[model samples]
Target: MASVFLLLVCVGTLLGSAGAQEAYDRLPSKFKLGVDMALEMRNSRAGVKRLLLYFKGLGQSDIQPGNDVTYIYHNFYMKATQCPKGTVDTSNCPFRNIKPEIDCAICYKTIAGKIQASPKPYINCIRKPALTEAMKRKRVNYCNEMGYSSGAPGGLADIGDTYF
Candidate 1:
């Protein structure tokens, strides 16, 4: 009986991880575009002193219908890239060694299927003390899969550290 229970637990864990991976895999192209839009929108309003941020981890995403319009929502992590505003390209930028902010946005698309920035997608970001272990892992995974480097020079270690 104990052996059967252990087996079930392991199977359950595997399934859960697989589901999480699938979440990242879904809407890959759209996801990248959405992140870019979110960044651009946020940067447009940020002051000169504010450091630009980039995608760190994905939290949740969904597509739903509202009042005859289709809206897509994304909850993700963004970390300071230590890059200047209007840098344009930050593909090789290193993450700043500081607390990451959680950014959530709700976006709508036009009939042409392009994410509309006007009606200006609702976005908000808050700095957290630290990201959870799961969130940190997600960040590393996201960077790796996207072909971007992960973490900062003196930031938390790749695997063991819980906060980043």
Candidate 2:
């Protein structure tokens, strides 16, 4: 009886892992990068959550929902823009009634391993204390490989809005 229970546990663990990997495999390449970057940035939960959403949207996952902010925010916080560009499915989305994905800036960048500074429209747009400049640059490069840039397609991603 004990042997049978142990076997069941082992099989269950393997099945769970396979299911997670399968879900990850179904996400778009950019979303995949976002997941990696999120993990690297020490925010794996949010990143994995986002990836699961993608899988769910694609009919790949029965557990995770695939709606909310589609882009990976450099800050590790989910800043969802409302309708037209992003998903309006969430009830607590403060960005409600807005259009255009550009309205949300979810990217961080670095050139030569140095973080580029920019104008801040938000009153509380403060620097992320946890991430260093080099790490920020690396994340930006990861997102770039995922094919997201500012205001256009394929090219040097804008320093501010670059995400995937």
Candidate 2, residues 1-164, lDDT tens digits: the string is 99999999767655644554465577655444544443334323343222111111211101111222122323223222222233334222233112211111133232332222431111111123444556555544544443343322212233343333
When summed lDDT is taken over every stretch of 10 residues in candidate 1, the lowest stretch is 147-156
Q: What is the TM-score of each candidate against the true structure?
A: 0.47, 0.32
Residue 69 lDDT (model 2): 18
* lDDT (Cα atoms) of all candidates against the true structure: 0.47, 0.33
Q: Which candidate number would show the highest lDDT if scored against the true structure?
A: 1
Model 2, which residues run further than 4 Å from truth?
A: 43-164
Task: Give the per-residue Cα lDDT of candidate 1 at 73.
Answer: 43
State each model's C-alpha RMSD to the native.
17.3, 17.2
